[model samples]
Target: MRLNAENIKGMLLRYIVAIVILAALFTLPFWGGRYIVMLVMLMGMYITLGHMWNLLAGYSGLTSLGQQMYIGVGGYTLAVASTNLGLPLVVGLIMGGIVSVIIAVGLSYLLLRMKGMYFAIATWMFAEAMLLIVATVSFLGKGQGLFITEARKLVTAQIYYFSIVLVVITTIVIVVLLRSKLGLGLFAIRDNDSASATSGVPQFKSKLYCMIISSFITGVCGGVFYMSQVWVQPYASFSISWTVAAVFIVVIGGIGTIAGPIVGGIIYVFLSQYLSTLSQIGSLNMVILGVIAVAVILVAPKGIVGTVQEKFGFEILSARRWLGKSLAKVPVAPAPASEAERES
Candidate 1:
């Protein structure tokens, strides 16, 4: 038997995707306005973060409440490396990811033993502890925190490009991982852990893998997220806002599908950005989002993508089809009438 790896169609498809996404990214920062670029970056980060949390909480059935711990660690690592250690912002971001991995291993060990509500509470408690610790540390300026001192000189265009690259890489990694055998195991576990275990899926290991992957991506996102702001503080970095926002996106987008997070994240970011200006009722934005999430879950528990799959036989999560949409018809786009036919 011969293996089929580098088929022409696959290679061409990959190349086209790469070119289109790259062209869009490079052209956007150059021609698009500052707010537009910012929105793009926001969507990228939201997609990555939402997907990360979804892997652990949604797919692997892990109820982690303390994802902020990794995010905070990554944020602080970036702050310390860039400010105190005098490293370049880029290098500091890498260091942040490396440090976050270490922290995640330890925290996972501590909390993975707990299940359900216990697991959720443990995660929350871990984040609270991190927040308190960072608050009291003088070197991190206690509550005041660190800012990228000379980073103002860095070009915004460069940051935008970097964010685009990060999103591209994250999307690729997620797609590949989800298509692999392990992704199959995760699905099984998510649906029924005991059954998957009985069938030899290694449920615990699969869950742990999901947690680590989710942590690593989310941690790196935190690093990049802070670098974008050029500042890091305990209150903001460790804020439950990350958790809340990610949760909302996953819930709204369709928890288990690849397109869910991306679609949901974009919607959440734009909606929040626009609705935040209204203060008549005080935080009506969150209230509205919360209500919407509840309604979506109750009405369409599978989310937009999931519901589409159930109703329309869509396969948006397939690895070969990145950026898959769930809508059934491609909108036949009215075939332009032939010139002669129109005349007749």
Candidate 2:
């Protein structure tokens, strides 16, 4: 659409607001306490995970329950690179993403052949198999897991900065992708794969692209998160809880929208931190989280942001491209008269 004055103003306003928010986040460590910094760090990491999952399941119609596999691979890659190969943690982080993409490429041939529940189950099984394999492998520290010794030299603030960068980059990548031709193909496939395929959309290629992109970013995010913890174990790294957290964040926040994960991540982190302190709840925090997710689904099936956007026409971060001006410029033809009216 041709840019109207209102559109221009709105775009400028959004840019200004984004810049201000980003500036504050970048300087948070200098002003915020250690606890707050750590909290935001967690929020960033989960938001990245949530975004990647949303891209796959929401836009591309690929509901994977094995994203944690990439997380584990990335974590182990980082650990081995730093501890055994004597490489910089930064290089290890990049390698994590590359390794994940490689694995994703190999898995896509098999997993992409399946659909719906079968696909989901296959992904989960793959993750579980990887967990067992890593546990039994002697070089990967066996069942004990490997330590990210290089991460020890880095402080919380540094790690927090890394998390901030990762989240920012991930968000940008998603936004850009959604506005591209590939994203259009993804949406078409999601709505109706058969129809999209008939219309000449490369179904397999689009799905594969989405899966590979999701895996690469997810792997990098995992590496960054484990770097903060300074440890990587099979059980912890390959836990199904990672996918569960992603689902909760996306579902509760608004699965398809850009702003859903951000809103959901904040809510999840806040509730998790608060619930963890409740002696009564103890390890049942996950149970409480599950309850809250169910409640959200029941109350607002589209999620908080999605429902609001649907009812109020308010989008916190809209991905729509308006064609109002272009459509307006087109000439409309008059309707043909009926036989009786023409005779009259």
lDDT of 2 at 302: 88
> What's the CA error at residue 269 for candidate 1, in Å?
0.9
lDDT of each: 0.79, 0.91
Per-prediction TM-score, please? Answer: 0.85, 0.93
Residue-level lDDT for 223 in candidate 2: 96
Pairs that clash in candidate 2 = none
lDDT of 1 at 32: 91
What is the per-residue lDDT of model 1 for residues 1-344, given as tens digits with 9 covering 90 to 100?
12245555665886898799689887997789989998888888888888888888878888677777777877788778878898887787777777777777777777777788998888888889889999999988899888866456666676776677777777788788877889878888888888998999986677777777777778878887877888888988898778888889988888878888888898998988877766555358778889989999999998887788779975664643233221221323456899999999
- What value does the lDDT take at residue 16 in candidate 1? 91
